[model samples]
Target chain A: MSSSSAAPGRGDGAEKPPMRDALVAAAFRLFLERGYEQTTVDDVVALAGVGRRSFFRCFPSEDDAVFPDHERCLADMTAFLAAGADDEPVRRVCAAARPVLRMHAENPAFSVRRYRLTESVPGLRAYESSVVRRYERAPAGYLRARFAGPRDGALRADVIAAAVVAAHHNALRSWLRSDGKGDAEAAVDHALGQVRAAFGAGPVAAAGKGPEDVVVVVSRRGAPLWRVVQELETALGRG
Target chain B: MSSSSAAPGRGDGAEKPPMRDALVAAAFRLFLERGYEQTTVDDVVALAGVGRRSFFRCFPSEDDAVFPDHERCLADMTAFLAAGADDEPVRRVCAAARPVLRMHAENPAFSVRRYRLTESVPGLRAYESSVVRRYERAPAGYLRARFAGPRDGALRADVIAAAVVAAHHNALRSWLRSDGKGDAEAAVDHALGQVRAAFGAGPVAAAGKGPEDVVVVVSRRGAPLWRVVQELETALGRG
Candidate 1:
């Protein structure tokens, strides 16, 4: 994962392709040395040996370069989810979340620095959050497609997506907090396991079985009496 | 739920003083009338009869005022979670989420207008993202505290919190998309119910039981397994 070289000029600097990676490396170096607030676009440009126009052409804003290639990763993840053959699309969606971990693993140092910066800076924090919203929506949409029925499967899909993201986020956040030195991929898997455990431990396969088995038991007891009956029926049906 | 009165703000008028609700009303009205981008802090100040400095004083930025008293609400929720006697804090945390829905319900029009503005304006959208981050963190922290045992309960708590917020956001976004008309509280309740069903439906009282009877399992099904197992073992143990 660490061996993959940073791609230059995917978004900006079409004429001078190398300027994009150069700017990223330059920006991270400068950010570390001068601190994020003190470092300007001019500093990054000067260090990267690129003109101001070239820098802006590569990255619309200074903050944009700090994070890894989220746009590309998101597209890849979307394609992966779309390409699933399994009828259990939620599992496929969960499987697709692995790429996000792989992405962070590709550049652990950059990921760590980006984590530190987002935590300290509000604008970057907002940018990071917007990216997370996008990440969450992909799986949510996929789950919705998978779980679609007459019921509020939209809500179910959204929660499943949320739990998946939540798991990923917890993994990522804890790993970042550990300065990316920890096993982020394992953390993500652990997080997703929680998602699976939360939504899994019962008759969800019946999701495709139709909305007839899907009862909304509102009482927050250990489990509603009806859910117990439903599970017994599901187990008996399986037997 | 809709009848809950707005609380008095801190005397500084910056930290949500007495006239906070009035300012929110004035700001939303101006946003609707003149358009959100065209409307200025000055316009909000003029309509609310507060000084320009006071508007800035109340909200560090104009975008901040679009939200209800989140700081106060977060604090209220934190207190609620801390004080809960439920051994399983996840249930208590889910219960605590209702205050957020109640806050929106109390001022449906204001929430609706804010939602419209945020959807249209990039700046407000950024601000909204930051607010959602806060929403995710509170339960994440509470869940972390309760489930920080040797097992991966910490990750479970974090994911549960994330799912809870995702459900809340999904419901809130749907209501906002619908222009805040009709059963937003119901939508939110449905969303929260999904969270409770996923995470909180487990056997909460199993903490006191012996490990052999606890029977921790993870399945790909969507039913509440922990409770089902608890009930099964309880039945089988007696048999």
Candidate 2:
């Protein structure tokens, strides 16, 4: 849960660098030079100029440091969603995803390196997958807040959030595999577009509508003719 | 990969069942009778009437025996999606999800028991999350196939897939948490409906050949006046 916090040690007047981030940097460097299996916490702490106690305070385990602080990201995303304006709930989620996208963009080198390591290492990859899924849930939580019932609400949120995160991974993996050769931002945008498109093209029109005229749908290109007719039928109870 | 063989014993059938199923059943019963932490692999195997080697053969670890056989389910889903008629890609994916739904519904008792243990045990909950995310990937994989591309293919597929799975899990977790008290099928249908609605009420409308022609959206119910007007405007793009 503490991983959702954005900046480590933010409350104090003193601006101490995050021990977690330093350890991660050291670990990544060591992983690249000495290989992931060979590297140890003792080695990382020595390189980061941090004590084992400080390292332990920041992360519960050595492997935990290899990932981003998702707990903080989740909390920040929650706050971003909670603070969203009353209108355009889906858009608000997309906006929240932007920060996460930017976080990767800002640290492309480190991200690419981490991606390489995670890809090559199965244990790290699984751990990374688990961590990323937690981030995916943040947007899901937001969607749940704006939807009707838990069944659809939770699903809708999870789908929306998962899409965004999946897009990021696709882009990140592509970029990493290319050694950062590709347009990462473009990749992120492309991925976010899918999420936006799915939600935009979806039946959410009814979600925000009144009971008197309860059918909700926005006309979009590429939809089949009869399917539209079916929705119309379902909404009106007759074709 | 041997997990996909379906045939119970081919020497490669680690986690394949009758044996696997029995072990899971025994584990759940023991977890209920005692507690998850108190239960061991030996207890589960002994109850299932299998030796220690056989238990390990069916499950990689004690914790894994408790989870839904996602590898088998994922493979089944992938094969189902691959086998779908070209004309009904979405329907095929929907059909694929049915087995997953059925797998849960088939043994509501086991599913319920596993859910209880997972909820109570933090480690089990984490493992449960891992399995859920893996299930989400199947739909994502299907979506990727539906829109495989030189451009916009991956993004479109991944996001749609993510959303679809999110919807599925949302429905599933709700049912699981409720002790199988809720309508599981309805929950799945509602979640799928959200996917349909998100993708648009139906397939995208076809383009008109003539500039002067009015593109009328005839629905089961009459198309909303606003949507009709919008369609008309779209037909005659304001050049």
Candidate 3:
């Protein structure tokens, strides 16, 4: 999101940046001064001192102006996931989610303001959900490719992907609600740690199962080996 | 959903059901014959042999007509989750999600048709996401209450809720994509079992962590409990 002020690489250096940033600045100013629904593309362009064609060239819709860098973040995340062929699937996917948080954290005050702005508008809220749904697809697609053979491969991918996104989002939301102060990375790391603990695979697959077959336990971190064994037994109702 | 044909208990069955059902039926017929954007509230009422007042009384907007039962389904799920005080958090939330699937399963042909309709219209797709977001809050809220003591309590609730919803939707989407032909319950059951395995807590607390704290491991099902512990030790790099 840091480079959102710079155009989407349609052009580079000194030509497109000012107009793009001006339009974004103008849109938020007007949106804050006179509510989101009350503002229009024409009003934004008028404030930005640009023509209507320029506005359309930069943003497909008014909502796009509200969330400028999602496309870049999504592409970066997709590329990152694509490059990780040998890593653990759950861990790789959780790491893949980091760039998204970085996008929001790159400009904390703007992200915080946008969070409040999105909360206030129904259209923007739905638009935000659709954007998030798009983010979830990249890691899910990656995991699906990795777990392609199991009958439940798609199901596992979907659930783990959702867990990673939810955990990251839960952490991000808390940080934003606190006015985007403190260490966003730490909050997200702690939250993503929960996902890893809950969904991560072992160094070796379960001993007697098929290579793709598995059983999982939701256990505590840092516990001694024997107690974790007891917890697994209790979870399976075998103790 | 079967009873979406009935009023929202706004009134009894003597007169409201036929008119309410007629509005929905007429709206869908017109939406299919003419495109959703091409059709209007006036056309729906006119086709139903009713006035605009009758239409608005039954549904607040055209989108609501497309997904008429979500409100009822959401209410049913919230009540179901609210009553599960003594159950394990993840398992209870998974059960709470069943009502939503049952709503779709209750009327499979209509669900398949509606899924197609939703796919074709971006506006309706966003609207549907908002509705699904509403359903997620019920279990998340319930789990949040059940897990209020720990610092990561809210985070656990959010991630577990997302996992449950994603698994259920994955199952439901496959069933709907199959033209709603098979046993939806069995499909949903299989998918949600993945959630139970991935996120479900042990029967007892971990030996060293707080009773409210937890750690979880995702592994294979039906494996020996000792194998699950081994997987955990391996995941934690203690092996």
**Total backbone collisions for each predicted model:** 8, 25, 12
What's the C-alpha lDDT at position B52 in model 1? 84
Cα lDDT tens digits, model 2, B26-72, are 77777768888898888988888889999887778787877646667
| Leading candidate by TM-score | 3
lDDT per prediction? 0.68, 0.63, 0.77
TM-score for chain B of all predictions: 0.71, 0.71, 0.79
Question: Mind giving the per-residue lDDT tens digits that candidate 1 earns over B40-86?
Answer: 88887887788887777677877767775777678878888878755
Interface RMSD of each: 9.5, 9.2, 9.3
**Fraction of true interface contacts that also occur in model 1:** 0.43
Maximum-DockQ candidate = 3
Candidate 1: interface RMSD equals 9.5
Query: Candidate 1's residue-wise lDDT over A1-239, tens digit each?
Result: 12223433332323435667788888877776778889999998988888999888777788778864786779988999888856465567778888788777766766776788678877778888877888888988888887778476788788788778877887888898887787777778766755654454422444356423433222223443324434543452331
Stretches of candidate 2 above 4 Å error?
A: A1-22, A29-51, A148-155, A201-239, B1-19, B29-51, B200-239
Q: Estimate each model's TM-score.
A: 0.76, 0.73, 0.81
lDDT tens digits, residues B99-148, model 3? 78877876776788889999999888888877777777888899899989
